[model samples]
Target: MALLVAGAFFMEILDATIITPAIPLIATSLGVEPVDVNVAITAYLVTVAVLIPATGWMTDRFGIRPVFIAAIAVFTLASLGCAFSVSLPMLVAMRILQGIGGAMMVPVGRLAVLRYSDKADRVRAIALLTWPALAAPVIAPALGGAIATVGSWRWIFLVNIPIGVVGFLLALKLIRGGPASAARPLDWRGMLALGGGIAAALIALESVRVTGTNWWQVATGTAVAVVLLVLAVVHLLRTPHPLITLSVLRFRSLRITVTAGSLYRMVITAVPFLLPLQFQLVFGWTPLRAGLMVAALFVGNLTIKPATTPLMRRFGIKRVLLVNGVLSVLWFALLAVLHPGLPIWLIAVILYVSGALRSIGFTAYNTLAFADVVGDDLTHGNTLNASVQELASGVGIAVAALLISQLTPLVGGGPGAAYSATFLVLAALLAVTLIETLRLPRNAGAEVSGTRIRRRDR
Candidate 1:
């Protein structure tokens, strides 16, 4: 179950990351500006963010087997659509379809692993489940770059067809879970509020990043999103059978990890989005060269995984998070100072360390998220965590786009300075999460980490 789900999960993430290095190529092919191609990235993620709230309910209502099968089919077909798209809008439309499939596929797939594994094996189960997250980014840049340079960029999307087919066949043969649990009444009000709020806010952020969007439109979108989100919070709190159980936030471990992890994700997620663009646009590197360079980040990600479990066992979650968070922030800050002429080895080393820190930090966050969650509430906890991850990643891209666009005009610097300013902004955002890490109790998540920490007064 873990292997099957992880394979499907890798397809989703690989689809997401592989497109990063190809964004510039696609923009030129589609006759759009480089900045405008970012919409393709944001569109898919925003669709996922908006619809992810409904995943738990959908899986419950539809049964996991059929739903998972359908998600794979949709994602596979949509990949074809993306490959054949001749225009930006067509590509964006295909991406939205792809997002809907991903929104259903990822959380439901994880839920299967959670249901199958024992608590004693959960750390290992989640590690196996999440390995794709590490592996996909590793392969995406080099593969995507190679395809874009040697052939048409369309092959990037087309490559998913075989993987999706294999996943579907294996799922049918090996996945033999029971019927879905009794269905919960759909939370229509919460769904509308949260979905609309998130969509509007993301669109507003994207609009601000564009060159000629009206200021009033941005203000109105922002205001509407804020109001709708506040109302969504109120409605969820008061209603029975809320779409997502925010009440789970009462768990200190879950709350801190979600709150802090969302910030960390928002900042770190921007790197993949911005890093490729900077390499191609600012450094004047070819897509293949840029991707090979970015592979250093991938190398770092892969190298750190085997060490994660032992590190948590030795240092405890709180200490590991603090140290990793600090190093991650420092490396991100380092990006702001890099120039086109830097030696390749130094750049590779920087990217490698940054990726290692990211891998450690994310592993710690994913493990600790479930530390305090118990039976029956496990579904809700998984749903909430998945939604936050998607939403934060979407906003991260939007935030990077907006920062670059706005700072470009204000700083009176070229594209390099614009990218550097954006990196600093993301670094500052990530640094804020360090404060949250500091506030954690010494023994936080000790139950899961298997490390003992003596209590100390804060």
Candidate 2:
């Protein structure tokens, strides 16, 4: 069950990251500017963000097995459409459809694993599910670059078809159950407000990042997004059986996980977004070589997974997080000083350690988030977590882009200086996350992590 869920999660994440390296190639093939093709990426993230809130309801109203299978099928067919697209509009539309499928696939699949697994096994289950987050982003750039170098960019989307097909078949045969209990009514009004609000906010963020966008356009987007989001908050708070139960956030574990964990995630998420651009633009490395260099992070990520659970058990979640978070910030500080004159091996080593810290930090955050959540609330917590994660993925890219756009002129209009400035800013912001971790009770998450921290008062 963990493997199946993990595989589906990997497919969704891989699709999202694989396009970064191919964006320019894709734009050229479609007779558009590289910057314009960013719409394809933004469209997918926005779609997923908008649709994620309703995933729990959909799984319950429909059945988990059927919903899971259908999502995979939709994603696979959309991949075909994306591959055949000859124009920018066609590609963006197809990506939106793919996003819809992904929005359902990931949360529902995760819910299934969480519902069936015992608490004692949660660390292992979450570790399995979390691997895709680390593996996909690190591997995608190198794989996408190689594909672009040797063949057409269309292969990037086409590659998902086989993985999706296998996932769909396995899900159909292995998954159990028919329609789930729909005791609670669907919150249609809440869904509309939340989806529209999130979509608007993402669009506004993307608009702010674009250098060519007019000031008026960014202002309008920002205004509309804020109004809709405020309205959504009101609706969710007042509605009976809200689309998602906000009350779960009252728990300290979940509150910190979603809020501060998201801040940390943005920095980690920015790596794939920034590393490729920095290497290719600043160091004058080819896309393929830059991608291969990025793979060191992925190797480091995978190498550290088996140790994560044991480390948490021995050290406790809070201490582990604090140590890893500080290490991650320090690593980013090192990356801020990277130069073309630096040896490739040295750069690779830094990335390797960075990857290890990223994997450990995120795994700790994700596992601890659900430490206090149980039974019926698992669906709500998982849904909300998934939504925040999607939002972070989009916002992370937007933040990175906005920083570079703002810093480029200040740094004398060079790509290398702009990227260096962005890393430094990110490293500084990431320090705030460590402060947030400090707020965790000294013995926080000890129950779920299977470790005890000795307290001074005791």
lDDT of 2: 0.82
Error of 1 at 69 (Å): 1.3
- Pull out the clashing pairs in model 2: none
lDDT tens digits, residues 34-142, model 2? Answer: 5456567767876787688777678888877888888899999999999999899899899999999998888788878887789999889999998887678767878
lDDT values, one for every candidate? 0.85, 0.82
What candidate 1 gets wrong by more than 4 Å, as runs, is: 1-4, 112-130, 169-181, 455-458
Which residue segments of model 2 deviate by more than 4 Å?
Answer: 1-7, 30-39, 87-89, 110-138, 165-176, 181-183, 209-212, 455-458
lDDT of 1 at 427: 82
Tens-place lDDT per residue, model 1, 1-458, is 78889999999988888898888999999997777677788878878876787877787788777788888999999999999999998999999999989988887888788877899988998988877877788888988888998998999999899999999898898665555668878899998999888878876777774367878978988999999999999999999999888998888778877899998988888888888899999898888888888988979988988899899988888889999987887887899888889998999999998888888988999888988889877767877887888778878887887888888887666888988888888888888988888888777787888876655622
Among these predicted structures, which one has the highest TM-score?
1
Hey, what RMSD does candidate 1 come out at?
2.6
| Model 1 alpha-carbon miss at residue 391, Å | 0.9
Q: What is the lDDT of residue 311 in candidate 2?
A: 92
- Candidate 2 TM-score, C-alpha based: 0.89
